[model samples]
Target: MLPPHRARRAAGLLAAGTLGLSTVFLGAIGTAQAGPTGWTFSESNSPITVPSDVCSIEWTITGGAGGFGDTNLRGQNANPRIVTTVVAPGDQYTLVPGGAGADHAAGGQGGTNTVGQGGGANGDIATGGGGGGAASLVLKNGQVFLSSLAGFGGGAGGGAGGHVPDSPSAAVITDFATTPAPGVAGPGSITGQGYACEALNTPPPAPEISVVPGPGQLSVWGRSGGPLGPGPGVAPVTGYEYSLDGGPWTTVPGGATHGMATPLLWLTGLVNGREYGVSVRVTSSAGPSAASAVKKTTPFERPGKPTGVSAKVGPSELTISWSPTAAPGTYPLTGYQVWAFHGDEVDGFQVYLCEVSASVHTCTAEVPAGVDYAVYVEGVDDKGNVGDYGWVNSAVVPLGDMPATVPAKDADLVGASGPITTVTAGKTVVLKGSGYMPNSTIRAIAYSTPTELGVFVTDENGEFEVTVTIPGDLPAGAHSLVVTGVDPQGDVRHLRVDVTVSASGTATVTEAALATTATATATATERLPNTGFSAAGPLVAGTAALGLGAGLIVASRRRPSA
Candidate 1:
């Protein structure tokens, strides 16, 4: 057979109309004018017939880069070329893009797109030089019409000196090949050249593996190096596979099969806090190698519950606080959740009060007044798992006398006294005051028994509004409530109010009046004061004697007058 270059040249001559052969038929009409169309040819060994109306073509051709070397001596890259040339209508042409050089033994030449020079080789002790990259070419009549020659790669010990294109963006033609194709021939054995190496038959060594635990998941990774050195294997590793608890092997995602070197593989849907055994192996054409030594890890779920949860009653709001000692599981702590429950434990309903970030220790929520409630706190993990609730307050009956902390000021008082304010025993009553030391704690005491009620804090204006419940067994009578706190000047401050305590569980009387009528009777008298009976008898005898004397005198006077 003729040499490769000579045969190509001879073929070109026959197709160019030089040897009286026309591979392309021309129209009888005169040369055609320019037409509106662009042509891009990329396939190797393929032909393109010039359009009947297109008189010329602006061609931009790119060459492929040389193959990568086994060592520091890399293959050189090829430069691209752009040219504008006149063409006859119906002329046949072929586009051949350059192929990348290969690092295989026997010094394989880059394929026909570009005629790459073959690489040189060493014995099994060292790898062979990468094949040189080929130049892109446009062929006519089997001859080279337009060609961009790329530099040959270094065979073994030398460095490559290849050229790079100045106008890479101007290239319109895609190169055909980057690596060697099937059945392509390598350089023939030459005298004094060492024997070429062959494909490996042994599988790759097992890889070193590690795992990180997450909530219900595990992240796994592997790298070359175990009982063997970093060389890993006699053959190229295609991928890696893993087995869980000695189960069937599963391929690692994004491994060499997906063109990744060392990808992180995740095992999900695992049980939290359960120990799992895992092993890994490398895969190659020879099949999977022995598994690596088993490693164990346990996945963690949500964090432990929070501690020291406490809720302070303040008017209609509860000031909640907690400790974060156990707020995070394996993951980071995200926040805390507060819940308020009303009624008894068996039948009550709960309300989501508020949520505060892990960094904050306190949260305030407005709640309904006068009801007994229990506040619960829980930790939230970054994975969105809420831990068990921590019970700080089991029976917190919010009263009207509870007040929130405020800033300190001067000594003062409010509603000291007025019309007797009536209050029922064993019920909540709101009392407001001002002018104590701001943000100071105070106590309310009920008299005349002087029994202590509850403690509270003042507000920024040195004011306070608190709820207090009276004692159930206190006798029904007038009483007073006194609140005492520290003044701004460190003196004791006191506020007092007079109140009438109704009978326990009863309403107080509202009216006050007096009655002014006598309740005595008189006895009847029988006679005049002293000597009553003798006086009556003498008066009667005198009346009779006087009548007798008067009759004798009248008889004597009548005789004289006659």
Candidate 2:
């Protein structure tokens, strides 16, 4: 049917008869009509997008090969019985099973049951519709292909042209009974079977790729196939894959040579020249199929720089090897490396081709063979790229014994960060030291605090450091640090550390009290203490001697005193 396009193209078109198709390769669901034919049958194709559930229009009825056996056949139908009914949208249907009534003898050729669909030949009463050839169906979209009506009419021929297609009327008729009567001579005959209700989709599998050659190994090839016959419009595709260089693409297994045979499958080793690329992907469960053209292969090529290099002296130790830099013609080498130098102490070498790819010259170690070392070698190619220029000096391998004395914090050893005992004035105490044979004549002196005790000197990793920040109060708390380690063979080592003088003294309030001067002084309490608690007791000295002995005498004069 092909019309309402919302995204439905799962295609298919392989026509013939019996209408029975189901291969879920998807592509299916309504709309199809193909019931009309006269002759010619080359097995048509090209209409494939079947996977949408697979149900566009499927057919296979073919059977027009019984005409050469003519017995004056008219409306042939010795006993043809095919009654499929269902017709609305404008009715119409017929079924005339009444044809073999006179000297009958034509029907028999629907072998293997109904293999290629063709068997209905025995009807020659004198003239009338019965040649057998008109009734192929394909209505899927809305469905409708009517044509089948052979009622009693053979006074001159004996009808036979009703294969019920849009059909209807005849209701239900499967009558095939005729053995001895009506014109006699040849009892019965009639055969033809094929169908198609709608359903055709099986096309999507054709991808390819190839490249074979493996000893060292490099092989890859494949292809996959599917739709060819089940016809409709666009059906016939096959593809496979293989790629490199840019890389990434592989698929091919027997998708479609169109017919059927084997396919292709193999992948090994790979790299031959360099630029390896390929592509192919054509698929049409019923639609897209067209994209192929892109292939390249150098698989081999490269001739130059990469040759003999050896070194394995032993005294101090050195081992190295290399070869394959001779490309006069056939190029094929993938790795080698070895590099070392002592007088100048060089450093570079290690290359093996493919996988870890790096090995240009040569390398095998064990120079501890005891000292004197110097070596070099390199090589690689197969797309693993590796070569960073290597070969430094100092390859001197006297190994063991001469490398242990550089320890005192070896940069060369020469430390002198002061006898920095206690420091925290300006806060810059960091006299670290480092020195190595830099002409090792190092020096560092930084003493700080009191009597202008502050100093700083510098040298190298033989050891010399200076970060002096302790110059203000030389006499506060704990302070005693001195470090000096030198070696020009004078060999003097003295380093002590103890510093803790967090002393910061400042406090003054001379004699302050002047808000109103007299902080508080109302000492009038003496009024009661004037003479009470101080008495020796004894009734206050007998009441002060009876008030001065009763002032007796004084009374004598005072007559009233009597």
**lDDT top scorer:** 1
Candidate 1 Cα deviation (angstroms), residue 50: 29
lDDT, residue 189, model 1: 11
89-195, model 2: which lDDT tens digit per residue?
A: 22211111112222223332211112112223334434432333333222223233322222221224432332434423222212232322232222122222222
Q: Model 2 — TM-score against the truth?
A: 0.22
TM-score of each: 0.27, 0.22
Worst 10 residues of 1 by lDDT: 531-540
CA RMSD, predictions in order: 44.0, 43.1
Q: Report every candidate's CA lDDT.
A: 0.49, 0.29
